[model samples]
Target: MIPHQWYIVLESREIKPGQIVGVTRFGERLVFWRTTEGELVCLRDKCIHRGASLAIGKHHGDEIACPFHGFRYDKTGKVTLIPANGKSSEVASYFHIKRYPVREKLGWVFVWWGESEPTHEPVYFDNVDESFSWSSSRHLWPVHYSRAIENQLDLVHLPFVHTNTIGRGKKTLVNGPVQVVRDGNIAFWVYNEVDHGQKPKKAEDLPPPDFSRQHIHFIFPNMWQNYILDKMRVLVAFVPVDESHTLIYLRVAQKFVRLPLLRKLVDFLALRFSQVVLHQDERVVITQIPIATQLHMEEKLIPGDLPIITYRQMRERLKNV
Candidate 1:
């Protein structure tokens, strides 16, 4: 996994007040819950005392009480009240459990990974706001998080994997697929002109990204967006469940249908179509050899892979920065 970056792990709606949600992320067992006032809290799921799962414990206001010994903890992972001891007992400093910093933005939950304090707010795209109604779905992919991300960055596979859907015209040749990486964000545009049985044009020969057209982009950690049009988009958050598993949170957002009731119907239908396309990609992605990708992996690469190569380079650069 990449170091010192904010990764989107869950949608904001998944956690609710007075409830503890437990899941394994980044190969670590974690539990998330909200205080009565609705502030998000994330902590290691294990109780430091007997190594029991904290998720099964009871939640009282902001404090969660261990079911086995009645040890209670606050949002900061500090033991606030140990029922086994007197109510006025002072908890030792060593009694605290591990806590992780969390933030919510754009209806997604982000967790900061690594030791360094975050220097900037979580990065998100503009224009995709509450005005655009969204519907979300999640799927578990038995591949590394990087592989799931690189699948979207791949431009050459559309015609082959999605031949019956997005690749209807058989535009087998690729051109330009220019990329611009700046400010920890990467956006790339494709210029796929019907090949006249000629060699593909180099990335330098193509124009820079035209945001007005349909394109794809990646935000530093694990968020991605495909701008289908001015009022339509498809977003994906590739969550690293572990070294060999990833949970993809896919959402379809649109403002084309403004009426509330009609919009729900439209969004629902759109999501179904999106799911079909996603499964098409999933079938092929799961079969990739050595599911995890490396910056220096052995493969015959071509000029059409400029976006993917840039993504790998940026990931390597972010590891130290």
Candidate 2:
């Protein structure tokens, strides 16, 4: 994971009001809960004194009580009360666990995973708004988050991997995939065609990007958007669970249908179909060697891999910042 960036770790619906949930994210055991007033809180799951998991403890107002010895902790992970020491005793300063800064945006839970303070809010696609109705689904992949992200940027696998669906036209020749990078994000246009004994064009020779046509947008770290149409889009968040696991949160958003019930039905069916398309890519992505990707690799690259190459290059630069 890149330091100092807000990484989406879970969906807002996963944790209900007055509910405390325990989950593993970023290779650490974590506990998340809402206070009586619905304020979000996150902390390490372990107790500092006895090494017990605090997730199973009871909630006392804005604080959580350790189940083992009845030690009470606040949202800041500081121990407030030790039952054995009586009510008048003051807890030591060193008896505390780690606390993480959390925020909620567009129905997603984001956590600050770096040593320094967060500089800004998480970056999201600006075009999507509340006017669009969306349906969401989750999938767990046995590969690193980087691998899952690159799969969406890859343009050469459509004809061979998804031949029956989106690649039905069998457009084997890839033209310039014009790309633009700004504010640590990438927006690119795809121009592919069928082979008729003609050479492919380079990105430099292609015309300027046509926003009126189909294009794809990606934000640094972990968010992607497939701009299928102005009113219809596919959004994905590649959440890291550990070094070799990723949880994909996929959503289909549309504004064509206005009726509430019919809109829901349409969103559901569209999401189901999107799942089919994603599974087709999943089957091959999981089998990739080394499970993770880096800026430099041993395999050869082609012109059609311009998006993937650009992603890697930018990722390398951001890892240090």
RMSD of candidate 1 to true structure, Å? 1.3
TM-score of 2: 0.96
- TM of each candidate vs. truth: 0.96, 0.96
Residue by residue across 1-321, what tens digits does model 2's lDDT show? 778888889999998887888888889889999988888999999889888888888899999998899999898889999999999999999988899999988888999988787888777888888888899999999999999999999888889888998777889899987888887788888778899999898888888876556788889889899999999999999999999999999999999998999998999999998899999999999999989998888769887888889888888988977
* Residue 246 lDDT, candidate 2, scale 0-100: 97
Per-residue accuracy of model 1 over 1-321 as CA lDDT, tens digit each = 887888898998998777788999999999999988889999999999998888888988779988889899999999987777889888888899989889998889998887677776677788588878989899999999989999999989888888888766778789987777887788988677677888888787877678888889888779899999989999999999999999999999999999889999989988888888899999999999989887888977888888788888888887757
Question: Ten-residue segment with the worst summed lDDT in candidate 2?
Answer: 207-216
Best by lDDT: 2
- The runs of at least 3 residues in candidate 1 whose Cα sits more than 4 Å from the true structure, single-residue gaps closed, are none
How accurate locally, in lDDT, is each candidate? 0.88, 0.89
